[model samples]
Target: MSDQAQSTTMTPPAPSDFDGRRAFGRAARIRTPRTSHAVWSPPADRADPVSLLEEQATSRVPDLVPVRHGRMMVSPFTFYRGAALLMAADLATTPNSGLTVQLCGDAHLSNFGLFGSAERHLVFDINDFDETHPGPFEWDVKRLVASFEIAGRHRGFDDKDRRAIILAAGRAYRERMLAAAESTVLDAWYDHLDVDTMQAWLHDERQAERAAKRQVKTFDAVVAKALTKDSMQAFAKLVTTDGGQMRIIGDPPLIVPVEDLLDDTDIDDPEKAAREILASYRNTLFASARHPLSEYTYVHMARKVVGVGSVGTRAWIVLMRGRDELDPLFLQAKEAQASVLERFLEPCEYDNQGERVVRGQRLMQASSDIFLGWQRVRGEGRIERDFYVRQLHDWKGSLDAEKAVPRGTLLYAWICGETLARAHGRSGDRVEIAAYLGKSDAFEESIAAFAEAYADQNEADYQAFTAAVADGRLRAVHGL
Candidate 1:
C-alpha cells in the first residue's frame, strides 16, 4: 500500500463520550472558576499564521486531498483562514470556566450564508459542517468572535472597532441563548432569518445601520442571480466540444474531470464505473412528492473543484433536468470523512461519517437540507466515508466582510450569536450558561483576546505552508 493509503487505514483516536448535559457540565466547570480568572494567555513567540496553516494542512485526514489542494492555493492568508478546525482543537485545551454548547465546528465568518428553505424562502444561517460535532457552545462563539477579529484586521479595521465587533457578538450570543432557552423548542426549531425578517429586525433596532441592511439586500440579489438556471449557462460556456463531446476544461487538481479519478475508463465507454456511480446516486434521491428533486432527471455529472480547503477533495456536481431546459436541479456530492470535531466528540452509533454530519447538522441547525442523507460507496479497500447531498446552489450567498462597515459587522455578529444560542439552547445546561454570561462584557473581551492570539497562530501556519511548498515537501496545483 502507498504511504497515504496506509495512513488512511490506521484509525485515529476516538473522541470522548460525554453526553450533551455532561459535556456542558465539563465546560461549565472550566468557565465558572475562570469567571474571575484572567484571559487565557497565548503562546509567547507565537508561530506566524502561514506556518500554523501549513502545520494544520499536514494533519488533514487522508481522504480529502482534492479539497486540501484548493484550500492551499487560495493564498497564505486564505489557507491560514481555513485552518479553524486546527484552532478549535487547540482552544479546547485552554483553561476554561466550563462554558459550552453544541458548536458549529467551523464558525468562521464566511461559513454563514443564505440558502433556500422548504418554503422556498431564502434564509440565512451557518452553511458548512465538515467539522461539526457536539462540543462546548463557547468554542463556536470563540471561533466566530476570533474570526471577526482576524477578518476585521484583514479589512484594516482599527483595534477598537474590532474589539467592539467581538463584544457585540458575545452580547448577542449570550442574549440569544437566554431568549431561546425561554422559547418553546418547536418555536426555536421553526425560527429562521428570511430576508424580510432580517430587514425588519435591523430596522426595528433603529441602530443607524441602513447601509448594512442595504448591503444584505444587495447580497441577496447577487446570490439569486448567481444561482439561477441562466447563470448555469455561464458554467456551460466553460465547456467545449472535444471530438464532438462536451467536456469541462481540465485544470488538474482543481477542475479534474470525473474520468480522471476512475481507472480504465475509455472515452468510448458509456457505462464506465464513474458513470455507474452517478447512476447509483439517483437511488439516494429523496422520494418523489416529498422532495422537489423528484422532478429532475439525471443529465450529467462532473468532478467540481470547490472551497479553498476542499479544492482537492472528490466533489461532484450532479445535474438533473426537469420538464424543460430552463428547469434544472444540481446536487453536490462531496466526500465526507471523520471530522476533526470527531477527535473531540464521542463515537456515534451510525457507521457512516456522512450520516454523522447529517445528524449533527439536523440536530444543530433549525432546519437542514431536505435531501440530506448519507451512503457508502466502494472506495480503495472498501473504505467507508460519508456523503451529504444538498441543492447545488439555490440563492446561496454571503457578506463580503472585507468591504462591510462596522454596522454590518455588528449585525452579522448578532445573527451569529443568536444562531449559536439557539443551538446551545438545545443542550442541557442553558440555565447555567445563561447565568454565567450574565449580561456582562467580560466574556466578550476574553474571546477577543483568544481570537487575536489564534489569528496569529493562523498566520504562522500559513507561512509554514508556503515554506513547505517552497522546500518541495508538499505539491500544489495552482491557478485553477
Candidate 2:
C-alpha cells in the first residue's frame, strides 16, 4: 500500500481481480493440515554430506578450505551451523505448503539478533542473508525450528525440554501470522521489533523494583553495552596505536590483513581494490544511504574470517575515516554465492549474486542497513566473487546458544518464530498462508514432528562426517 493510494480516494479492486478471502479459501482447499505434516524420508541414494561439502569447496578459496572443515569438526551443532547447503539439498525433497516468500535461506537460531535500523533504533530480525532467495516460506521455518532441536541436543537438553522449545517456536509462528493476517497492510508495514520490546524481557523488573530501581538502571546499561559495539569499539579491539600510528593487528588464518594474505611479490594494492569495490557498492545504495558514505575515505582492508557456515569465503573488513580520528566507520564486505534454495526452485531473476542477497534482505526486513549494497571483485586468478557491504558492527549482538538455559532458549525460540512470521508476512500472501495454517496446533505439531525427525537425520549425518574425519578422507584443523 503506497502513501499515494492511501491519501487519495481510491476504488477497491474487483473481487475477481483481488480478494483476500477467496485467495485464502483457495489455498486452504489445496493444502490441508495433513499435507503440511510433511513426511521426512530420505531416498536410498541421498547425496553424501561430505561429497556435497567437497563439491562446494570447488568454488571457495582453496587455502582457507581446511579452516572451514576444522570449524565443522568441533561439534554436531557446529557441523549443522556450517551445512546450510547440505540441509537445503535434503529439504528439497520434503513436501511443502506451496507458500513462497523471500527466505533467509539460512534461518538458524544464531542468525536472529539485534542490530541498529536506519532509524537508529535497535531491532531484532534475521541478520544473515548470504543465501536468501524466493522460496517456500516453510523452508525458513523448517531451518529455524530444526536448528533449535539441534541446539537443544548440543546443550544436552532432554526430549521434553526440546519438544517444549520447538513447539513454542511453532506456535509463535502460527499466532503471529494469524495476527498479521488480521492486521491492515499499513499496520503490518509499520510493525517492527523495537528495543523497548526487548528491554521488557531483558530486565528483571521485580528485582529492580526491590533494589530501589538500581537494577532498573541496568536496563539502560544493557542497551548502552549493545550500542557501544560500533566501529570505535571494533577499532579499540582490532587496531593498535604503535609508535603514534594505528594499524590493524594480524592474526593468521582468522584475522590476517589483506597484505598478509597476498604473496610478497604480488603487484596489486589492496587499498586500490577496496576503493574500486566501494565505488561499485556506492552505486548500488539509494541516494539517502550513498550520500552519507561520500564523507568517508577508505583506510585499510583486512581479510576477516566469519561465521560457522561462512568460513573459507572471501570476507573482508574495510576501515574508513571521516571528520577526524574519532569518526571511524567499519564496513564488512562478505562473499555471496548462489542461493542454496536456488537449485531447488526457478532460476534467480538477478544477475549479480550479491544483489540477490541485498534484495532478499531488504524485502524480508522491516528496516535494513542504510549502507547495505553489493559489488563484485576479481581476485588473483581473475576469479570473480560477489559481496554485499554493511556496517560491520552497528549495535550487533548475537545470543550465545551455549549459554542459553532451557527456559531462555524457549523464550528466544518464541521470539525467533514471531520474527520469522513478520518477515514472511512482509514478502508473501499472509492472508492465504495464514488461512493454510488455520486455527489449530495440528500444523504446528506436525512441523515439530518433522523437526525431530530431521534432527535424527542430522545427527546420523554428523556421525558420517566424523567417520570421514577419523579415516583421514577430509582434513580437520581443530581449535581454530
Give the best candidate by TM-score. Answer: 2
| Residue lDDT tens for model 2, 1-480 | 111111111232242343654365345435434345546777787899999888888877677778888888777888898899888887777665556679999999989888899989988889999989887778788889999999999999999999999999999998998898888878876777887876675565653432334333443555678888999999888887668755678887788877786672132667787898887789899784547899998877788889878888878888888997788889999888898778777688998899999999999999999889998878676767788999899998767787666776777798899999999989886776677687878767888888898888889888988888899887877777
TM-score of each: 0.79, 0.90
lDDT of 1 by residue, 97-213 (tens): 444345667787788877766566767778887777666566677778877877777777887888788877887887876665455656655666676677566556575444455
All models, RMSD in angstroms: 7.0, 6.2
Give me the candidate number with maximum lDDT: 2
lDDT at 141, model 1 = 77
Clashes of each: 47, 0
Q: What shift in Å separates residue 327 of candidate 2 from its native position after superposition?
A: 1.1
